[model samples]
Structure formats: structure tokens, C-alpha cells
Target: MTGYLPVVGAAMSITEYDQHRDWILEKQRDLELQDFITADVLNGNWEHLAEEVLAKLDGYTGRLGIHGPFWNLDISAADPEIRQIVQKRLDQGLDVCRKLKATHMVVHSPYTTWDQHNLDQYDQGHSFKLQCIQENLGAVVAKAEDIGCTLMIENIEDVDPSIRVELVKSFNSNAIAVSLDTGHAYYAHGSTGAPPVDYYVKAAGPLLQHVHLQDADGYADRHWAIGDGTLQWPALFNALQKYTNHPRLILELANNANLPKSMRYLSEQGLAQ
Candidate 1:
């Protein structure tokens, strides 16, 4: 908590939270919510579980974040109708964040190689895509600002950092920032031929707000705990030190049970105290 905002993923449901409550309470860590908790926001299926979840977290005194719904929901959809749906879902997610008193929310960038190709062949295709993102996200950020929340747009299938940087900078809103997932970046490095993971942190620089700290082989998004897979952590952290003063660091492991192992690895490496 000294140099970064360290948090653990509170698994999707209250049931899952019960399983990890002991360890979470013992460690006194903050939380980054799993996608399941907010999945209903996309379909307008509110389970009214926020009050229940808040009750369970009564004693926690750390910051909270939610991984917003992104399953088949593209905010930058070219279709106006689809974009409207995207806005509705994100607005619901923002309402949830406000209810939970969570300042940071993680949202996915809708950029993909396929989309890029489709967007091409038209004059100012890239500009059109940027406009789509800016127009949609600009409205979303207005709501986020109303709720006093910041949306951290994460790279999903990004082939490079520049586009993602541009997407965030286009909004130019304090409520919009970037979230770097190390595992995703590592997997993208091989799968999409993206720059090294550290380059992303450096590129995002001051705009970097949240980080999903996990490891993965270049082949797939294994989400293995740090050090369990090959990632240049020393170099990544060294580069990160200059960019953010206290970015939220969530150990976004595939299996929440590995939180201890991941936390221990960071501590043992003197990256976290």
C-alpha cells in the first residue's frame, strides 16, 4: 500500500467470498470485484446483491474496484443501437460502483484486429473508430464523473499500446484512465505481436491508473501467479516506478485461491511490503 494500491479479487459471488473471507480478512486487503458480480448489469438483470455484498465487507477499510461487464458487450460498436446498449450497461455498472463506493472501475477496450480491418477501406476509418470510442466513452465518463468514479479502460486484444493510449487520451477526462493486465499483455505479445509488457506501462505512464498483476506464458493467458510463469517482473516494476505514484494493483489470478502465492511472490521480491 505504500507505493501502489494493492488489492485482491473478491470472487464473483457472496458464496465465493465466503470461501476466501478468512484469508482476505486476515490480510486486511482491498478488493477488485470479479466480472460475475456485474454481469447482470449488461442484461438489466439486477440481483440486488450489492447491499448484501456491502454487508459482508462491513469491516474492510480499503479501496474497491469492479471489473465491469465486457462479455460480448462492445462499447465502441459501430452500430448506433449496439452502442446505445453498451452505454446502458456501462451506466448500470457505474451505478453499482457508486453504490459500492468504489472509485475505480475496469472496462475493456473494444479494439480488435478484425475490427480494425473492417474499419479500414473507408476514408478516415481509424478516425471514425476513435470517434466511436470517444463519443460513447465521453458520455459514459460524464456519468462516471457524476458518480465520482474513474473508468480504467484495459487492453483486450490490443496489438500495440499506442491505440489504447489514444483511446484514453481522446476523452481527456480525469475520470478515464488505463488498466494494464500483465498476463494479457504477455499473451498479446506473442499472440498479437504487441510490444513487451513493460513498454505498455511506460507508454501509459502517468495515464496508467490500475494494473492487473498476473503472469502468463507468451502462448496463452494462463493467469498464473507472478513468478509461476515467465514475465520480466523486475524490469516491468522498474519501468512502472516512474509512471504511477500509487496505481491500483489487483492480483487478477484465474483462480482466486492463488492470491496468497502471488502476494508472497511480490513480497519476497521486495516489490510489495
Candidate 2:
């Protein structure tokens, strides 16, 4: 179903995904991958490359997830006009996905405005920020629904997870859900005192549609392969197993020679073959 965590994966480019096509297919069969994301293919040739790669990974059967444009993609602009501009990036991303026949698209929430101090700027009457987010998001959701694609909104560290929940609640659409980023949750826990989890994923478990899993150093947002870092793999896996959310799991590991070892290490941590 849509909820089975896939442990599907990615690479630096289409050429890399093609190079590992056999491996990806073999692993998909072995692991029963339900969904996965491709690495950033921002040069606009993503459509052509994705088509070729999917044809090669024919043995693989699963859902596909795509990460929308990330560099300076201000989906949460404070300005209404600029917010409209940012929304176009997400639209373009889905246009690419529609061409590739993808089902779910992961997008980021708007960032809170911070001065040089990076303090709580929300109290500075920043509720309008959420309005901008909603306006852009509503538009994207309309497009996604037209194509029968789901928009999975990922959580950011600075924004309270509760806020994310509220945002979803505000829109109240079936076409929208949450994409919990594990590494981001870990990085959000800084010396400045952040809650363990915004409970965004756990709270919105039912609507939790996608996952991006990776191990991190508990400080930097290093997307290390599983087991190469400090995250408690067994515990996390166990929690996931019991989760009613049943979000699709994408291994979402770093692309490097270290991948083989990392994959094996995770299999030992409750992800049985």
C-alpha cells in the first residue's frame, strides 16, 4: 500500500542511477521498496534522464518521490508577491515529475524570518508568514491534485513542529501530507534547546505520507549512510515499525562508495531481508 516504507534510494545524477540500475532493481526486489527519491537533477534535463533510468530499472516496482527545487526556494516568503514567485518552483518540479510519472512530491515549509540574532521573530507579528505559506501551498496543492500527486511537506528545525501540524490542519486537504526528514529532526536538537521531535510526524501520522531517512552526527546535517552515525538505528526502526502512520521509507543515504557497508549495517539493525 502507500504506507509501506520502501528503503528505496538515490544517486548524484541520472548517469549514476543508471550505473547502479541493476543494483537498484535487485535491492528493490529484496527489500520490497515501496518508494524512493532521486538525487537533485536541477539542470532541467531531469525529464529525459529519468525516463531513460526508469526504463532500465524495469525489474523495480514501486512509487517514486521527488524533491522540489531547494536552493533559495522560498516557499514561505514574507511578501505576498514573492510568495507567488516561489510557488512557481514547486509547480515546475511537479511538471517534471508528471513527465516522469511520479506520485508524491516533497516540499519544504516556509522559513521564519530571523535578524542577525536569529531569535524568535515569529512574535514580531509573523503570522502573516503562515498566510504566505498557505497561499503558495494552496496553489501547489491544486496543481498536484489535478495530476493526482500528493504534496508531502517536510519539517524544518527552526519552525516549531506544532506549527507544521497547524499548517496542515489549516489547509485540511487529503492531497497534502507530511514528509518527515529524520536528519533534520536530529539537527534541530541544538544547544539552544529544541524539542526532541516537533511531533509533526508522530502527531500527523495518519496523513504522514512519505519519509526521508538518513543518519547524522547529531549536530551537523550530514546525510550519512545508515549506521555510520550516532542515530540509534534499532530504536528508530522499532519506532517506525510500530508507527500507525506507515509512511513509505526511502533509505535516503549519502551517495558514496561507503554505501554498501552502510546498507549492510542497517540490515543488521532490525531491517531484515
Candidate 3:
């Protein structure tokens, strides 16, 4: 805390954001709007939602981002038809970002535990996956670049962290970067035999630009408050100090009411302001 006071942010829906708008605007904390992560919202009258967000967020100044549509949309689909659908969904998400003036969008990683065990079993297996990613997301990445949005690839069931780092690097664009979800990493550590959460920070290093700072019991993605779970916050912060990128540490809790409790815990621990 002496050398750096990490900026703490939160991920919430429009309703939740409005409920806590006072606290959020008072501090001008970085925010990741979660309302654009589903198909229903993406297909519905999202323009109205954008207008509402813009009106509510008026006079507030902080880093704004959104959780892009990810449900049932795989960015590495091998089928051309499926890839087109995926591309459409993601492009729709970018449209939301464009309307909201969001600078970042969280996207789920395509790598899974199965890929870790079997990706190298065949010749050019990993390379083929990369090709599929390029085919599916090439245009989307270009669009993101135009809209001044960075796509953060978040780990879900990934066991090998370096695999995503490699994927982010493959695009070779500033709009593509790494996003670490703490609870997911902890689940991978305890349930999927992945390395500890701190290892993920070290692995991503400077490429890491966003973080979902939820707590878990190392068994599942609990999304609990900070002190309520078994994650090592100090170790995670220590590892984060190695890079000067100052990644956005967002508290992506399941219950937004517990945001105050989580902030209190981090403040008490001196991990974040």
C-alpha cells in the first residue's frame, strides 16, 4: 500500500449500478457494466439501455468497461456457420461498447482443461486452434481497435494460464489483452490442478490489463466477499506489484449488496483503497 494503492472497481448490472450509484460516483471507481453479457439483453432494445446508462453516468469520470456477450458464443468455433454467429454476437457487444463509450470489454477464454491435456497430442493441434481464433475474431479485433476498446480474455475453465497469454499475444494488437478472474483461477487450482492465483498474475505479467477480484474457496466460483473466502489477497497483490500496468482490480461479486463488506475487507488489509 505504501508504494501503490490499487484502484478498486466493481462489476454490476444497470439495476445494481443505480442502487449503488451514489457510492460509485462519489469515488468515481472504475466500472464494468454486466448488463450486456446475455443474449436477451443483446437482442433487446439495447439502445435504450445505453441511453439510460449515459444519463445515469453523466458527470462521473472513471474507467468504464462492459462484460461482452459470451453465453453460447465460442470465439474458436471450427464450423464456419458457428463462427459467423459467434462473430455476430461479439460484434453486437462492441456496438454496445461504442454506444456506452466503454474502453474495455471482458470476453471469456476458449481454452478449457481438456485443451491442456490434449492440445499437443496431435500435430498442429494448438496451431489449428489459433487459426480458428484468428478466423473467428480477426474482423472483430479490427473493429475493437477502431472503437478504442480493449478485449480482455478472461479465464474460465482454463488449467494452463500461459495458453491464454499466448492467445492474446497472437493477435499482436493493443486491443487484445489478458484478464484474470480470481475465483476461476482458484477453482482451477483446487478442482482442476492448476497453479495458484498468484502464478496467473506472474504469468500474465505486463499483458494483464483487467482483473475480476472475487473470492472463492478454491473449489468453485463462489464470487464471495473478500475476507469470506480462502484466497490469498496479499500474495496476489504482491505478485501484481511486479508490473506497472495497474490493471483494473474489479470486485465482481454475485451479490452487489456485499460490495461494501468487500471494500472494507480490502481496506482493512491495505490491499486496495
- Order of all candidates by lDDT, from best down to worst? 3, 1, 2
Q: What is candidate 2's lDDT per residue for 224-256, written digit by digit as tens?
A: 987777865555555566566556666566664
TM-scores, all candidates, are 0.89, 0.80, 0.98
Judging by lDDT against the true structure, name the best candidate.
Answer: 3
lDDT of each: 0.76, 0.62, 0.92
Model 3 scores a C-alpha lDDT of 0.92
Determine which window of 10 residues in candidate 1 has minimal summed lDDT. 5-14
If the candidates were sorted by their TM-score against the true structure, best first, what order would they fall in? 3, 1, 2
Which regions of candidate 3 deviate over 4 angstroms?
Answer: none
lDDT score for residue 104 of model 1: 80
How many backbone clashes does every candidate have? 0, 3, 0
lDDT string for model 1 (218-237, tens) is 88878887789989888787
Cα miss at 73, model 2 (Å)?
A: 1.3
* Worst-scoring 10-residue span by lDDT in model 3: 1-10
Please list the residue runs of candidate 2 whose C-alpha ends up more than 4 Å from where it truly belongs after superposition: 1-12, 27-47, 112-126, 197-200
